[model samples]
Target: MLNKLMHSPSHKSILRLLRNSMASTTPMAHLLHDTARQHWRLLMLYLLFVLLLSFSEACLFATIYQTMRLLLGAPSFTEIAGFGFTQGQRLFLLLFLISALQMVASMSRAIAGILSGRFAASCQRSILPEIHRYILSLSYGCVSSFKIGDLSHQATLAPLTINTEIDERIRLLTEGLLALIYSLVLFVISPWLLLMAGFLGFCIILTQSWLRPRIRLAALAVEQQRRNISGTITADLQVLRLIHTNACQEDSNRRFANEVEVFDQKLKKLSNLRSLLEPIAELLPVLAAVLLGTVSWILSDQQNGLLIPGLATFVLALQRLNIRLAKLALSLNALTENQPRVEILNQLLTPSGKIFRRQGGTPFSGLKEAIVFKNVSFRYSSRQEETLTSISFTIPRHGMVALVGPSGSGKSTLSDLLIGLLSPTFGAILVDGKDLQTLDLSSWQNSLGVVSQDVLLIHDTIAANIAFGSPVVPSPEAIRHAATAANADGFINRLPQGYDTMIGEHGHRLSGGQRQRISLARAMLRNPEVLVLDEATSALDSHSESAVHAALDSFSHGRTVLAIAHRLSSIRHADTILVIDAGKILERGTHDELIAARGAYADLWERQVHGLSRPHLHKQL
Candidate 1:
């Protein structure tokens, strides 16, 4: 039944109502429906357990009523039929049976609770992985548009919220079923008492219905503020060095304090609302019980003469009924409050057709002749001006191709295009006369190794980081060979645990040069057909750079190498150099040939030589 409600067409109307009340625009019913489908079998079993527990719970109440009748000296129905034991013996037997029934009900409820918890846990397990997979599937551009803190909070919190919602709702359902059974038994005794309970329950339901939208709105506000707080803290932490250097600690503290204060204020408002509702919920149950008890006493004294045992049973059942109604209201309120969270979670977890990275194309075997870019142009969606314009280049197999240009001259954009991270807005990138788009990007990436300006290292051992790309840990000899090729083996050998040593987060324990060398080793481990170095050696000091250059010389002969360099001296020995200026290739030639041409490349060379010689000139002074 719950599963049916989750997917029923009526839920869409409820969502529309919620949207109108809370002003949430994201559609979420589909996401929740998908989640339910994933665990429907477990859910059905959980409901089955609860149903059995509810019946046992009702039987326990019945036993209690009969035991009270025997204690109160009332005649049992069996005695009226002339077949009953004496009251003393009857009470003793009732006590034993009540104890046995109570124990059975308790154990059954416990088992039901366990199943309910497992079902909730299974929902979380399912949602978490699906969210992760969807995030991975999103386009690079789409993923980058959201703050990391916001994304991380939603991903982690959403599934947890769903789990809680499921558990609380299931518990409410079972309890309500038990209450219904008790109420029915009361109705059989005295319709008057049941009628009063019906009125009180109706009042509770009306109260919850009126407050449901408010709770949802408050919850939505709370979540939005939480995301804001997370984003603020994350941004502040990332620039802690800048804050301390500028002596802006007090300002940062003030900002963080303000954010937290706002968050707290929202929390207090939500708390106040719940506090107000809880008292009303508690008081209604008491008033209903008092009214029922008074009516029962009056009825007992009348000529119709309600029996003492029946009155006692009605009063007990009414009290239980009151508790259930109170619980039902609270549970319903809780479900309403979490509705906004579910919507947000659904938005985050749901796979959007337009936002996903493209998939399904023929596998790129390997570079056959050359990678050809024909009049390619690209502009980021966020920008009006083109980042690359009518750019043309060819990188042949087994040679070095260097792109040199002024900063922001589209060198990096071209590299991003070449690596299939960004598709061109116009024109095509071809491999061996075939369009790059026709080949599988994943396979293309697999064959290409990249060492960038900002290298990422996981918090792991040297060997693990070096062989991170592989599904299995590579042989130690293979790891060592890669490390030797990147000139990282020397440093690894000197560390306390060598290859077994834990590198701190982002390789924080290693020096910049050491980190770069380790990154190079990781790329070399792939033994890629094409190697891309985007300022890979820029972080290294002169001696380390020379060592890396020597390693490159030994390794570059068999693979196509693409280098984006700021230090002009590094690419002087390139097989071909393309000097890009303002999204256009102004010059292309062998390094010596370009220098003779005295074009953009020659001008850049002069400036770099003068820059390199400045220290010597200063020493002379």
Candidate 2:
């Protein structure tokens, strides 16, 4: 009989349904599925415990039916099952079986709970690092498109949501199995009661289906509002100084309050919708009981003694089924609400959904001769006009090349291309006559140092920040040497903690010139073969600029340098200067030679020199 049931079409169908229900095509679902397959032993053990729990429940229900029969004096044990036992013996055996079933049920439940918690912890441990690594691997443009708050939500919260979804899915499966077992037992006791119970269950499912879309919509609204609120707060905090200087505190407060109010409204609506499922679920068993009693009365023609025991057992099974059904409904609702978060995580983790930087196989050691750009052009993906157009330049080994251009004239874009942060949309960049795209980017970047106007400093000691990204941690001596070369040693030594002083977030505690010098120190510590400076001294005062220029004069001896600057004085001694305007290089020569030509470079030099001569006049205008 057991074999026949196992091989039955209905049984096969049930197995297929459960399998299909668990399988999903979403990226997060795929990750969890792969994780589960890797830990199949634990998963199988968990299922075994669940099955044991169901068996204990079944045994408990059977014992209840027997106890009911004994209380009503329906039949002796010998008459019912041909057992040669006295009434007292039969009663003792039934009570002992009940106790044993409860013990088994408790043990199985506890074991299953422990296994599930461990599995969740393991999944989280494996998933977080993978997400972080993938985020780091994404192309610069792709990552920049996300707001800080939105990206934070994706990285920290989305994985947690998916993990919870996995747990809820398991619970849904368990409840489904338990519900099926109870239904089967109800069918055996009384088919008429089982049919009524099935009808009531169908009603509950229909009600949940009606509520599902509304709850999901409300959940989406709440999630969107949450992202908005987080983004607003982060943006506000980051620019707190600006707000204070402008005296916009009242406006900022009002804006934040409005956002919070909207979030509260949406969150309240979502809560109200989710709360509907529980109360509806709780009301189901009462309806089932009423219907079961009515059906029993209608079938009163049957033997009262047999009917009473059967009716009692049928009600017990139906009540258990309803509880499982309600739990299943709640799990489904929770999964529905988290569906949007799952989709966001899917987009983030899925390769096809994100832009990943291309990696090459060939390793690069160091520049041999020159870095050349051959008719390179670049347009942002969202723009119609190219940012850099057909630009070409070369920085020979140990040579100093400078780029001077107005704002939005492609100077920084060119530097980004040289640094490998961005790839040219057309043409090619060659390092030692080899295509830049064909060389390993990591190897190429490791040999280059970059310092831009906007310095990035973490909240760490001076030495730690200087040595942050070096392939090898530098010794204290090396760090000091780099700082001295950047002209930052004096200021750092003046600090009470010296190299061990903790900078505040983004190094906000430091002056602009101090921050720039630390950034330069970080770049110099790499001992790079090439140094690319993007207006590195633009924020420095005259004294600091002179000090940095003095350091650069000494430091540029054996290194190839690419300098992009608006202050022409800094690049007056560069070996070659390229004047760029409207995505094109209008002039290329030494600064002195360009001045002699009296062209665009000469005109810019004249304007800057004139502006400095009459600073008050320029400020007034």
Candidate 3:
């Protein structure tokens, strides 16, 4: 299957990606190392507490073993009881002391585990935002190159499992190390059990040789199944409303069930492997005990080689070591299986040097300046064909410009460029004639307002959705005012809870027009110098479109608005209309000039005036 995966292009890409990702670990390791170096004091304190817990456990086990031997191997119960005291009070006091020590060790170990959990969770929480920022900051083309489900899987689940390794594996590893030390201390007191423990250790190593990789493979399958399930779930959930409304519920159910069944089977196999492990491991110690018991009985018959009263102590300590070693092996397998996902996540979360962070994000030379595309060109990374070919145009300062074209035209491509979602392949983009590369990317984007045809609203309260990630918090008054400007206030006020009402899963609770208006309101509240409307009213009915256009006209009056619209009527009023087709501008003019000239605009206008006309008919009037 792995060789077949290597042959498949999609999975083959993952292999190549894995190599890049392996190299990528240098920075993340450095990040972890740097953090450790800076917070060595805290780390040392954490280690100290863990060691204290381990030592306490070791001491309790040792004491218990010794007490058991005294009780069992002593010539008489009276002799054992009389060693330290003359009456029953002596044994009672010894029993009480042992119980108290055991309780302290158990409680402290649990406390240390909790502390480790909190520390791991805190570090995980800190790493989360950086991961989110890295994924969010990636270029749109780069983001589109992967499945959305895969990225989300890498972002959330992968980190969670890797953190489990830190929280649990390191803790288990240390416990085993401490137990081995305790075993050594026991060995110092007796030779028979020491030899027996060494023989058991060898047996365990042989058992684990095959056991570890099988367990790791099972775990790997579990993780792979989860990613597939996540992708399927994400894609289906995105259009769940449409699926149910269109009576495709059964189809959607089948898809979900298919993913669930596959994931469940993988999980079952992994669980089965884990179930089989400890039984096989138990054989290691049982075999060791049989051999040691036989050897000890024969040695006891010899005059010089004698049986010790503390034989039970060595046996007890050796048993504890065996148990912990088995657990350590289990943890090591889990860590190895999860390591690949951690590697992939490190790649997704690593920062790219391409985006330039502002030193301080100072104001641009002209915040209110127009945008210019000086011979821009772009093609999606996955596509061989160019989407835009040497496109050049400028929006007049504080003026309205509309990009108009048919399907597959460069209108949307140009919109992408104007919004800085994609950089030009060969030419410079400018704001106030300053190279865009010179300005801070995030700050520059913050200064722009965009309402696209694909109206994406979060599943949150209406007011919260409008506020979104506004740098300045949106007040009730501000939110209401913005909603009114987008002509969404009236409808929103009539909802059961008004602005406090939750949109419910991608705003499915609202109509299409309602969703679009909320998006418009969001952009309006920003009060940006550059307003991008990519078919803002295209999704609305005529009645709703009228309301939206009125709001848009007011918005366009003050700001530099660049609109890409299919409706020719909207662009007829634009100060300049660029007739774009097949990635190049066919013409650029005012409404009347293009109409009289009988260019591409005139044909589109004539065709619209008559009725919907296909572009296959003619190029112009």
Among these predicted structures, which one has the highest lDDT? 2
lDDT of 3 by residue, 499-539 (tens): 99998888989999999999999999998888899999977
Model 3: ten consecutive residues of lowest lDDT: 1-10
RMSD of 2: 5.6
**TM-score of every candidate:** 0.89, 0.91, 0.85
The order by descending TM-score is 2, 1, 3
In the order shown, the candidates' Cα RMSDs to the true structure are 5.3, 5.6, 7.1
Q: Tens digit of lDDT per residue, candidate 2, span 39-139?
A: 56676788789889988998899888888788778774545788877888888888888899999999999999999888777767766676777778889
Better of 1 and 2 by TM-score: 2
Ranked candidates (lDDT, high to low): 2, 1, 3
**Residue pair clashes in candidate 3:** none
Clashes of each: 0, 0, 0
lDDT for model 3 = 0.71
Q: TM-score for model 1?
A: 0.89
State candidate 3's TM-score.
Answer: 0.85
Worst 10 residues of 1 by lDDT: 1-10
lDDT of 2 at 456: 93
Q: List model 1 lDDT by residue over 1-621, tens digit each.
A: 121323434234322332233222333444444555556666667677677767766776777777776666666555676765888777787788778877877787787778767866776777777667767778776687779888888878766676666556666766778788988888887887788878887887788878878887888898889989999888887777689899999998999899899999998888877776677777887877777777777766543333666777777777777777777777777877787677777566445533666687888888879988899999988899998889888889887899988778888888888888888999999998988888887888888888988888999999999998853468999999999999999999999999999998788799988988989988888888988989989888888889998997777779998999988788888888988877888889998899798666676666678643334322221
